[model samples]
Target: MEPGNQTHVSDFLLMEVTDDPELKPLLFSLFLSMYMVTILGNLLIILAVSSDPHLHTPMYFFLCNLSLADICLSTTTVPKMLVNIQAQNQHISYTGCIAQVCFVLVFIGFESCLLAVMAYDRYVAICHPLRYTVIMTPWLCVLLILVLLLLSTGDALLHGLVLSQLSFCRDREIPHFFCELDQVIKLACSDTFIYTILIFFVVGLYGVVPLCGVIFSYTQIVSSVLRIPTVGGRYKAFSTCGSHLSVVSLFYGTGFGVYISSAVTDSSRKTAVASMMYIVVPQMMNPFIYSLRNRDMKGAFRKLISRITSL
Candidate 1:
């Protein structure tokens, strides 16, 4: 059947995280709490960066963008899942599902690129302290962000457009809470060779290439740090990167876990569970990781809170 003829399709059924009726409320509360925390934490990070003149550097600028991306990424999936759980109806409109896929791709791609950019920022700050201010100008930072946004949006729209062309089986059951790209692709009744090729190209370009850039940036950072003669200088240099390193590890680790789980196991439920680590946990944890590890972020948060309370 041609995809054009399938315009009558109204919705797709999203599988719940569990079949046990008793666990629904618990799952709902858990996810709700996590979602709230993710939002609040990331928001505070943004507010702190904006409010504090001390955080007006390239690192915090990138951090602010990362926080925004985390909020967006979490918002893209969690609320819809929460809505489904609350309504006890796992049905998502066809349009909503496609929109979710597009936003997820955009935010995910943007976040990946932002992390790589952050690593480069750190590399410059540490390896070329004398040139840091001159090199990372405000215009360059803004341009990098604009370029990343454009690329991510373009990639996501391309995928969404291709997805709209594929016919789906009558059994439009997506085996995950959200309309995961791979699961949605599995539902297509038409040939998905082109889609598969596109996925590989995107993963290679957005995923592998950024990861390599991060690795390269950190390599230079490490080499420069090692050459520092004093232990205190080394600690200070490494400290600057600790928060970003932790985030990168969590992001990639959980992301890799999702891929491995999906590959090794036939259980869709397990795959969904693994995805929570990637999609939910990191956003929730990022604020804590930055604030706790970095003195500057901690001070910024305190100052922001003091101002808020004074009002």
Candidate 2:
């Protein structure tokens, strides 16, 4: 197997990023629309958090971070997909492929950690109201986000380095839409056992660990909410968590469903469709989920509109 050299790899064919040739125009329009909404929705959340003095709190602080992460997450994949589909050029250079995978890893991994942080933030705010201010101080929130960023960056760099070691001989056509690590590694002609094992550990670290954190935090939150004597108090606590829980459930549900379907099912078509639900579909759904369900954000948005009209 030849090592990764400039002499080889004129280009890599990306198979069926969009299947139906006649439908390509429709898909391009649809994805382009979704991309626009994803950007605008996330940006509005960031702006609402920043501009609203009423939202100058730890909860909103963490929410803005989530919005930023989602923006990065969606942009890392969708825009590239759009460009590839539009230009009919899916051949990313070696450097570009690595860079894309690195970001895809960073944002998705960071989001997993960020969700845990946000869960803990909700727990502290609800369970220990008196100590919420002390527990989730502004510095502490920033510290958590910074930690997520550092860890995610390191993780992505590791993935890129590991992938670089594998020799992409003869077959370079990726089956999936984006430069997914799993799909790319499958294309490697060299022995990829070490890389495969490394992926298992990394998946566990980035997926399971953060999921555990979210579970533990929510468990404590439920316990605290259960202790609330008044119906109104219970309702209020649950309401605060409702939007977050919905988003979390949607994110994890679609993602886990894809994994399970892909693993157990024999059909590649089924797996591919599931992948779109988890990855492609979520970019549009996230903003809608948050905006429609989150009252604070909706109110903040209304305030924004009013302010704009006043201008």
TM-scores, each model vs. reference:
0.97, 0.93
Q: What tens-digit string does per-residue lDDT give for candidate 1 at 1-311?
A: 23333434689999987778799899999999999999999999999999999889989999999999999999999999998888889999999999999999999999999999999999999999999989999999999999999999999999999988888877788988898999999888789997799899999999999999999999999999999999999999999999999999999899999999999999978998898668999989999999999999999998999999999
Candidate 2 vs. true structure, TM-score: 0.93
What C-alpha RMSD separates each model from the true structure? 2.1, 2.4
After superposition, which runs of candidate 2 have C-alpha atoms over 4 Å from their true positions? 1-10
Model 2, span 1-311: residue lDDT tens: 33453324555655565667788888889978887887888888888878889898887787788788778877777777788888888777777777878998898888788888889989898888999888888898888888889999999998898877767767677766777778777777778887789889999999999889989999999999999999999999999988778878877888899899989998766776677557656656766777787788899999888998899
Candidate 1, run of 10 with poorest lDDT? 1-10
Per-candidate total of colliding backbone pairs: 0, 0
Single out the weakest 10-residue window by summed lDDT for candidate 2: 1-10
- Shift in Å, residue 249, candidate 1: 0.3
The top-ranked prediction according to lDDT is 1
